[model samples]
Target: MNGPTRRGDLFDDVDGARRFTGPTTGDERRMLIDVLRAQRSTLRLKCSGLGPELSLRSAEPSALSLLGLVRHLADVERRWFRQVLAGQDAPPLFSSTTDPDGDFDGATDDPQVVAAAWEAWRTEVAFAEQFVTGAPGLDIEGEDSWRGTVSLRWVLIHMIEEYARHNGHADLLRERIDGAIGL
Candidate 1:
């Protein structure tokens, strides 16, 4: 309640700070990227003013915490963009087959854990952004073992969906943590 949420948190004016313009009209690629960027910024906004509370779980049966969401999304980003799309051997930073829920289950209320989650999320996001920027076109195809064949467009839409869904959960978790709420 006294100082900025953390050392470098700039959620005071998330839109102004992050430059997340939710542009409604543009080419398909630009629009998709902008929307995804907006969704990503929304996640940051939802978690902006908290430190340890990022690890607060919602209910007894659910391991759904804001920190968990961050970690899980980090894994998701790595899986989709790095492994599936870019054909990199990037294993998830948090989860493994033996413990698929490690992202959520390991979301301890420790500063180090929170920092790692944010770092991994940001790194994966950066890679995804760069991949999108460098791609020849949205029609570029990638072979996904599960989905068979996926295009950049499909991946972008899926990432947007993933973030949007998790951001909704983030909204609730943030409100539960401190009664602060907003889109």
Candidate 2:
């Protein structure tokens, strides 16, 4: 693998790049958010600069692509943060109960699709951050009808795990698209 991949001209230096960084020192909440942020950044870095067509193309035999991952993550963020945690009735960002895999199935080569995926992902991330920031503590509970009550800490850890797992798929998908690899 190449030494930390870089997006040419888009970032000035390693510091400016969207690379993962663990928390140096902080409380559990701060550390959790830091880890989650790093994972999110890793996903963005993995998807950067591959044009729209390549972004949508699945690695043969598997119906998975970076574009699909982006849309899927957006849906996940909206589901967990906005709907379950914030108790908002936000509709699914890219999928529905009828067509549950719409996020991946509907991923297309159009640049608009890629742009929309990123927009929705960023929007959900912002809303999640805002909600977490305003919450009293990590121990605060949220009602998930299917999963019963869950705490903010559980959600944060789950989000981190979600990103980490998808990022692994992204690593393979990205490598298949272009030879780029590494954190």
Candidate 2 C-alpha lDDT tens digits along 71-171: 99999999899999899999897889899889888888898888899899999999999998898999988899788999999999999999999999887
Candidate 1 lDDT, 1-183, residue by residue in tens: 676453222235646355455567868899999989988888888888689999999999999999999999999999989998899998888899999999999999899999999999999999999999999999988889899999999999999999989988997888788777665
Best by lDDT: 1
Per-candidate TM-score against the hidden true structure: 0.90, 0.87
Model 2, stretches more than 4 Å misplaced? 1-18
TM-score of 2: 0.87
lDDT of 2 at 140: 89
Q: Candidate 1, overall lDDT?
A: 0.88
Candidate 2 Cα lDDT to native: 0.83
